[model samples]
Target chain A: MKRLKLFPISRRAKDLLAGKLMLLLTILAALLVLLMVAGLYLKSRPVLASQPLAELLFSTKWRPFRGQFGFFPFIMGTLWVTGVAVLIAVPLCLLTAIYLSEYAPARVREWVKPLIDILAGIPSVVFGVWGMLVVVPFIKDSVAPFFKVFSTGYSILAGGIVLAIMIFPVIIHVALEVFRAVPQEVREASLAVGATRWQTVKHVVLRKALPGVAAAIVLGIARAFGETMAVLMVVGNVAKVPGNVLDPAYPLPALIANNYGEMLSIPLYDSALMLAALILLLVILLFNLLSRAVLARVERSIR
Target chain B: MDRRKVEEGIFRVLMVLATGLILSSLVMILLTVLVKGLPYLSLEMVTQTPRGGYYLGKGGGILNAIIGSLYLAGGATLLAILFSLPVALYLNVYSRPDARFVSVCRLAFDVLNGVPSIVFGAFGFTLMIYFGLRASLLGGIIAIALLILPMLIRAMDEVIRLVPRELMDASYALGATRWETALRVVTRQALPGILTAVLIAFGRGIGDAAAVIFTAGFTDAVPTSLLRPAATLPLAIFFQLGVPVPEVQGRAYASALILTLLILIISVAARRLSRRLTRHVVK
Candidate 1:
């Protein structure tokens, strides 16, 4: 401790200075998060206040050009697309997770896990282009035609399919963690009772990991809900509630992403999109927090 | 017993099929892009900017977008690292494991991370309008920095948390200050994780389009300053895909291929480099 003070600052004071820097940095991070939420609300206040919240949420019509700004079509579009995505994805993801955790050898698991992660990391824009160039054409040329439905390449089915593929990895990754958390002793005990390996995974592992799996599914749905570019590219961007999977739909993110630029010129257009963005933020935030709470509880048990 | 056996076999088969399908999508996604993009993947395609009528499948390349994306994502990644590193360090170093502040911060990050990238664009648009900032590279960088902050910080925090606390305590007991312990000991222990976090942020920042779409303001020319509008690979793909021409659509695939390849290189390098860095770590 017998050293010359650095510019009149003591060692304890230096420690305090370092601590203060960290505290300030943490405060900045928190403030930034708050700013994002506050910014959305304040910016959208005009549209949010002008109409009843229920009307904006439940009204079936949306006409930006004629000044009608009911966002129900977009909300339903988002729900229909995300719901179909989760519907298509959850079962597939759960099965894959079970296979990875129970059936695959250690060597196989190591190689396969990274591929799944890479799938998760593939950019939305890449997926968007692929959907535009391939999936839409396939749906139009084959899938929809086979069903004898009136179809454009871009429709809710295309959007949902793209989202299903995109959200698969998120669900599978989470489900894997859940499955791995199932105690080895419990698995052995189930097998010892003359249960088949598949039986143990089905009855024991599945039951044990149900909550985590649900959380995983919720996370996937949240991601599907929030997705913008890919869904926008494939969903046909029509501001109407999709009648069926083959119908064109405009999701909220798609609506915002597509029109926010031109919105500045149109009266109340910017505010409407801002309100849509705010709704998306709230929904996604709720889903994420719910999933996080579940995961946290599961983590405690697994630990 | 016979029924159970049949069900088990059926389920096993279904599992294999499901896993196979999931994995094949990745291969299919990659192969489709590679096949469609390779013919258009020439030096000229990478070297030249879009000439007039470029969207109609006319001459020139996506050079402006390529450079501009590198600039914006790269700049944003750098900025995110500076702020995220400290926040991550603060979470792991300055606070107890179950501290309220730490939990609140983590929860906040969760919410931020959950908020869609397009919302970030909206928020950025809001702030830019308020501050009199035009759509430019700076606006995009800042927006993307905010977008990736939670991701980067959470990733780094996870990595730093994995470093054994005993190692940090030992460093502090050796008369090293908290700053020194954090800088020299904790950072070294988690170097690989930090590198991986940085790489992930880089990949995310580069690949993301929605957050920067409103803020970046697409341009055909490469940005010469932070104030100038910039073109990103994702936006380039979006614009080209919008063109009705088949030739232009092929270029969209080509651009997506380029963007995918960049992310691939970063991930591959990060994995290999992380493995190498772990050789020096005590863990």
Candidate 2:
């Protein structure tokens, strides 16, 4: 009887210990985010201390040699590519969401949803290869001739188009969910008032879902801003202020990726790259918080 | 009324066209990669390492990269599962779903998911520098695991959430502790979902180029130790594509072909497993 009692007690103790261990592991998962942010900020101090923020933000030069370390061109490059991507992706994604949520037949929706999922799951390197083999050559052969000078097709335009394609499915999926989440009663009320289906969607459903749509767009921005390999491969990796969409330009992710291996040879290069990583982190964090704020408001409305 | 009718028609046509565009693009990319990469996919590519001047479009194969990729991704997947399973189990079994702490933990994972891979590479580089650990299999594994941890945790959490509460109550009524229920009953029910989460994390880790690019230094040999420099398939493709030779370019296509095939197989398996999990669960 004593032995049986001890066995059960011992097993209960083991179970309690297991629960504590899981709590520790969960904390560890959260700590990793804090660790990354702290590491990036703490490590970037040397470069941020030695250089003026004004020069780093405004100057155009990015030559690693001769001690020049301007990041303006890279900042511009990141903005340009991401801006073009947003311009191409937002309208089309919104329309696709409307169609899927409101108009798609059940069978078509089932088939199409998985297709988008497959697209989202595709590896970035495959996209890079596709961009390299198909998009760039097509642009060079067909689009370059119309320009005043010859272009290699490996330009910001190519980068943006590829990024647009990469992020399209992800953003549209969220938007579709948001649209579907509008209360059915609200749609019925609009229809009872003699409103056409299009009118109801435009005035009532979309208006109710606007905040969620905004959140989705911000998330998509956060994604495209720091996208690395696919954009890096097609963007031509030139360090210059892009004169036009067809001009080759350097972006921040590409800059860090390309020069990372050789950073040891240059003064403050590692620190500079660390600073770049810090900026990317903070900016993405800001966008994330904005979307979270909007999403919270949405939850409040639902309640 | 006429103007509104015209507007509605135009919007309808445009939306349909957008859907068609995505479908055609997916088809176009798959066909393009397959057409260019199929002829070069041979057993030689899987059986031999690159010889001298391999980057210059010479003879030999990419066996080292295949093995090295498997090591880095495989190691990362194992490490991520260690952390992810505990967090997921804690959320679904030990705590209530609507608990404030649970939502906060979920938020942390969401933000971590948004943090870019390049930034993870930067973080790993910092850690390596501070510890005096040069690029190695271990360093790369840690970086990729961190990069995929949030994704792994979230996927597993969704699966765990689907585990019915009645089962836990039943186990408790049977004198089973919370941990016993979680380990035996809860985990048993979530096995397929857990496996699918593993597949997703593995796929994410193996295909990532930016995150592991710095932490895993390049080599032409298979990784034999945790402390040695390792190569990966994405880096292999990147290096070959840079060689400016048509022959080497073809090899890049072949490497990409292998990588894409691995990803496709994993994705198909994951979908299948998730479907099975839904049907076979709690029956």
Winner by DockQ:
1
The residue pairs that clash in candidate 1, if any, are none
Expressed as tens digits, the lDDT of each residue in A37-99 for candidate 2 is 899888878777877889887888777676668999999999999988888889888888898
- Candidate 1 residues lying further than 4 Å off, grouped into runs, are A1-9
By summed lDDT, which 10 consecutive residues of candidate 2 chain B come out lowest? B274-283
Per-residue accuracy of model 2 over B27-92 as CA lDDT, tens digit each: 777787899888877888888999898888777889888888899999999999988998999988
Write down the TM-score of every candidate.
0.97, 0.97
For each candidate, the alpha-carbon lDDT, in order, equals: 0.89, 0.87
DockQ of 2: 0.73
lDDT per residue, candidate 1, B118-224, as tens digits?
A: 98998989999999999999999988998898899889999999999899889888877777778888988999989988988888899999999999999999999
